[model samples]
Target: MNAPEFKKLPGVLAFQRGLVITDALFFNVLKDSQTPVMVVRHGIRGTQNVNKDGDAEKSTAANAKRQEVSNIQTTDTAKLEEEAQALAVRFGLRFLDLKDVLFACAPASTDANDLVRNYRDSVTGFIERAKTSPGLDEVAQRFARNIANGRWLWRNRTIARQVEVHVSVNGTPLASFDALATPLNHFDNITDAERQVAAYIADGLRGDDDAGLDIEARLDFGVRGALEVFPSQNYVEDKPRGFARPLYCLGSPERAGSRNGIEFESTRTMGHAALRDQKIGNALRTIDTWYPSYAEHGRPLPVEPNGASLEAQEFFRDRKTSAFEFARRLNTLDPASPEGMFMIASLIRGGVFSGGKE
Candidate 1:
């Protein structure tokens, strides 16, 4: 019920869907908190097209002209979506529709977007609009709180109002009372970092992790570090060892009523716990992905970045999640599962981009 109560939390952990796709990072960060994937997708805009026939099919044809949204083959997409849903069911988590969210993220660009001379403005026009919504701030807080509370759910679609329980999943990590072991069933008999690296890279490199969903990639430590963020469920293992608490425990938040804005204090009640989780799946795999990718690559940057962190690793995780899921969901006919599809849709529509990109 409170942030401090989570100091002993074992069910929370940071997570990333694919390699460093910016959108994918946002998807995992913001997934199903206050809003469903549908609302966010309302923001995605694409360019307009002119129909070849010019009159009868003008509207539909026009859409096809500028950008060709590949004709989605429902068979493959549905299969992937269903599999994710089935998996979530095993974990007691729900799945959301991706098509609705994709549409929201990929909005119809307007004349103003075309008028902008700056390239960033042209492509980012939709993203800019989406950012204006206060809904984003609200979602961030809701997501944080849900993780703090062991297993919470949004009771209403109107996330702006008072919080409710048992109504939705953005707040829930899909836990069930059972003799649950590590969902490492995807990991198998034979073991080698080589196959692990290869398989993980393949999913992260694809458009979305929704395709060829394999659990074998979940074993690495590097992937866990990168996703060392909130709602820490991804890091959790089974009872004995996985139930470590938060490294930095902050006290319950209070509004700085008389101050300029909001403020809070950190509580030193705890020392630290290993912030382990899915970063091992995507982030660590990415370090390997990059070495080979850039072995004989493009021209050197204007100047190498001087940052301490390997941003490239994080970025890889985001892209892989977004790209793989986008391709997978767009192709799905009936997405009964909520895990990847909804999160993927929200992220694509959310217009999440890696901060530093040319």
Candidate 2:
């Protein structure tokens, strides 16, 4: 008789992200005072240039035709006050118990029940393995180093003359670091104090305490004078005609103005230029140097199941290194290995991975 067909993965499986990051709010710092940096509107005359999708002659003809029409419009701009000497970005970080990582799992058939059970058992085993292995510790250190290096500051980090990062837990100061001194390209050369910070975060991830972790990070940029600060940009599909650029701000939504019969809402009431929690989280998890092409890439990408780098427009991992494949063969993987650590890290990062076999 033929052997029974092997069951596929569960039809519905999902895991919530273990790491919790709050939105980073922007502030203009002057001595002992802090004020919200407001995003204001700026009107300017700009040249119109539209490139066509064909050969050079076709593109040149299209551009020349579009140049006949004026494209001057208003844009959004954010900057520190003239007296402000620095920019301060503050955000909160928290981690959930990895032991309770599974958010959902629904079996479509009796045969699939075995697959579900195996996955659940694997999660428990992996957690125990992580406790004994250095997998969790290494991942935690990379995150901590990212925080200490002020990598989340993005473009602001390049403009700053000096950068200072402060970490606090539950309103109590834990440690502060000179963000500039920390290397941005690698995680191996971290200082002793940074290691201590990583230990605290690792303990929280391991579910060592029930009090729950409430960590906050503040990055202070010494710019010496007023300068333009970068904030998350809003992706508006149907933006108003003249309003070409809209920045993300923390505030109540209200009608800011209208251009060419289109009305747009403004988030400038609260007057805080800020970065989204998603952006900050992405920066913190930029520790995926285990991808097959890391030797050629040199820099690390964010910890993603598919090794997706949106900025670079590339997928660095194949099916063998993907989270789905790792989960399928969890029993065979050593938690201390790079692939094993990557899978665990992806669990912490979290997302739905339901097989659509139903």
Query: Can you write out model 1's per-residue Cα lDDT over 1-358, one digit (the tens) per residue?
Result: 1121111111111122222221111111122321111100011223333455666444533234445544321110001111121101001111122122222122123222322223223223322322342332222222222222212211111111221111122332222211112111111222232233233222322322332211210111112112222222222334232122322111232332353445332221221111223322222211111211233432111101111125443232244333233222222212223222233223422333222211
- The window of 10 residues in a row where model 1 has the poorest summed lDDT is 74-83
Judge candidate 2 at residue 330 and give its lDDT: 62
Q: Give lDDT tens digits, candidate 2, residues 95-214.
A: 777887889977766444366777677677777888677988888888889988888888878776778888877677777878778887787876787887788778878887533333
Candidate 2 clash pair list: none
- Alpha-carbon local distance difference test for all models: 0.23, 0.75
Error of 1 at 272 (Å): 8.6
Off by over 4 Å in 2: 1-7, 51-64, 109-111, 210-225, 253-270, 356-358
Q: How far is candidate 1 from the true structure (C-alpha RMSD, Å)?
A: 27.0
- List TM-scores for all candidates, in order: 0.20, 0.86
TM-score between candidate 1 and the true structure? 0.20
